[model samples]
Target: MPSTPDTPSFHALIPCAGTGSRAGTAQAKQYQMLLGQAMVMHTLQALARVPQLSSGWVIVSPGDSFEWPTVNWPDHFRREACGGATRAASVFNGLGVMLQAGVPAHDWVLVHDAARCLITPEAVSQLIEACRDDAVGGLLAVPLPDTLKVQTSTTQSAPSPSGPRVDATVPREDKWLAQTPQMFRLGALHAALAHASATAFAGITDESSAIERLGQSPRLVPGSAHNLKVTYPADLAFAELVLKGRT
Candidate 1:
């Protein structure tokens, strides 16, 4: 793993280039308003509010605008345009930008989604501070409150009329749902992702998988349900309520 950069401060990498087809909106979901501003705007605000988060860089799509072009960014935030097909690809491109800008390897690189509008500065601070100990890196996660399920191998239990197992719910013993703003040392995370991409294992979903791929387990820092991503349109309403609480 690479060593941490001399710069101890955290920098945010918000990937706002997704089409958000699941959101069922004409405009990209990140460009849509949750309370009043664009979804990405809220996420950027939450990160920027963290005193330790010295700066922010948003990765936007090639043709698409970073946003409506009317609303201005926070004092120190900047924009970049290299977005990728997968979230990992987009992040890889942004990492390069940060490196070219001479960001340190030790600096905290937080990868947050644009749709998670309920995120708060407090949550961001928790994530940043947790990354301090080099032995452990952290990701915001919520313990499982709902029951989980593990169906049989086949969709149908009857296996073509032969005796078969039942569609049973799995025991929710210690499961946790992972959230974003996942922070890690620039060098460590970069090496992990690079190794994963080098092999045929490009299907990894989250940053945790990249760590696990390198034979290390990432620590989970508790996060609230309010940090849920805005996948469906209804999620915007939930995020609106979450935002109201923090305000």
Candidate 2:
């Protein structure tokens, strides 16, 4: 379907441009097998269950040669090769394409990570419901459940031989681990990220961070711990276990 304007719509913007060097995979981790399909396929399948989403766009880096799974793929969701060097850049560029394609500025965009294949439709729906009427959008997050730690400061000449011991225990109160499907207005998120583009998107780790720089606070809807991003090799095993359990 073609992009429509005026009426507010929910769109999923997934940035799938990163190299999975840390994952020890020969290809991008998103394309790596998970359960019976590609890692990102699981992510997209979950998004397809959300009835409120108008469309989903997967952003891949230019010249990405990975063959995407086409069988049973949602017609409303498609891939675009407008990815940038960093996650923030990919998101910003994706937003630009959406706007140019006639997506309304007031429309809601849920930015999710392709590696976070465990995200459920329920969690995404919760975020949409929580932020749909609010002035600023929100993201699904979980309160810090584990004790926080700060690494000991080390000098350039001398490093800790004990593999960087913890210097202090940080207060976990009021601290939350940010998670994906960060819902925000298209114009708001685009402008926030555009502000940081000059600095190569430095300090902009997530969509919420970019929005925070605009002096606006995003709401935090409680998220499930099961919604984890697959980064390391061990994480894939855990994700597969979880996916199998869900089945």
Candidate 3:
């Protein structure tokens, strides 16, 4: 079905410019091998199945030479070398490319993390449906199910040999762990990000933060525990186990 002004098309903007220093890999974490293929391949494959995404862009840094495989790559997705130092900048640059490519500013852009290889098609589709007609757009998130804690100021500044100590246990009644496919309109998101870029993108952790600075609250749709971002080295093993179990 073709998109109209009443129903704008959906596009994916994946910021793949991060160095992944936290993942402790020789290469970028997204390019690291997982289940015999690059971790991002799994992420891209999941997005490709959604069917609603009219186009997708993988924003990589200039001079990035990841050697992407040719066979079976999604035709709707393309790689662009306009990534920036931070995730916020990368997405902002990618949005500019989308605009230059003639994509309508009213079209929706689902900005997802490339390291979150465990994201499933159903989850992406769920987010799209939930935010399709939303006034402010939304993101996939899960309610905090465990006890929340705030560490002592001393411990936070300087940890002791005995490990950090919890200062207080906060209520988790309304807390939710934010996750991705943070969906927003192309023009709205671009404007929100442009405002943050003036301050070097401070306090702009995710796409939602940029939107929040504009006094707009994003809706949080239910997400799965399995849709974890592959951050640490140990997480790779855990993600592998989960992926293998699914197979």
- The top-ranked prediction according to lDDT is 3
Candidate 2 Cα misplacement greater than 4 A, ranges: 1-7
lDDT of 2 by residue, 1-247 (tens): 4435445789999999999788889989999997779999999999999999989999999989988878958789988899999899999999999989888898999999999999999889988989888888999999999999988777633676768887789999999999999999999999999998988999999999998988999999999999988989999999999999999
Task: Kindly report which residue stretches of model 3 are placed more than 4 angstroms away from their true locations once superposed.
Answer: 155-159
Comparing 1 with 3 on TM-score, the higher-scoring candidate is 3
**Per-residue lDDT over 212-244 for candidate 1, one digit per residue giving the tens place of the 0 to 100 score:** 877887888999887899999888777777777
lDDT of each: 0.79, 0.91, 0.92
Every candidate's CA RMSD: 4.0, 1.9, 1.6
lDDT of 3: 0.92
Kindly indicate the candidate among 1 and 2 with the higher lDDT: 2
The total of clashing pairs for model 1 equals 3
| TM-score (C-alpha, index-matched) for candidate 2 | 0.95
Record all residue pairs in model 2 with backbone atoms less than 3 Å apart, i.e. clashing. Answer: none
lDDT for position 45 in model 2: 91
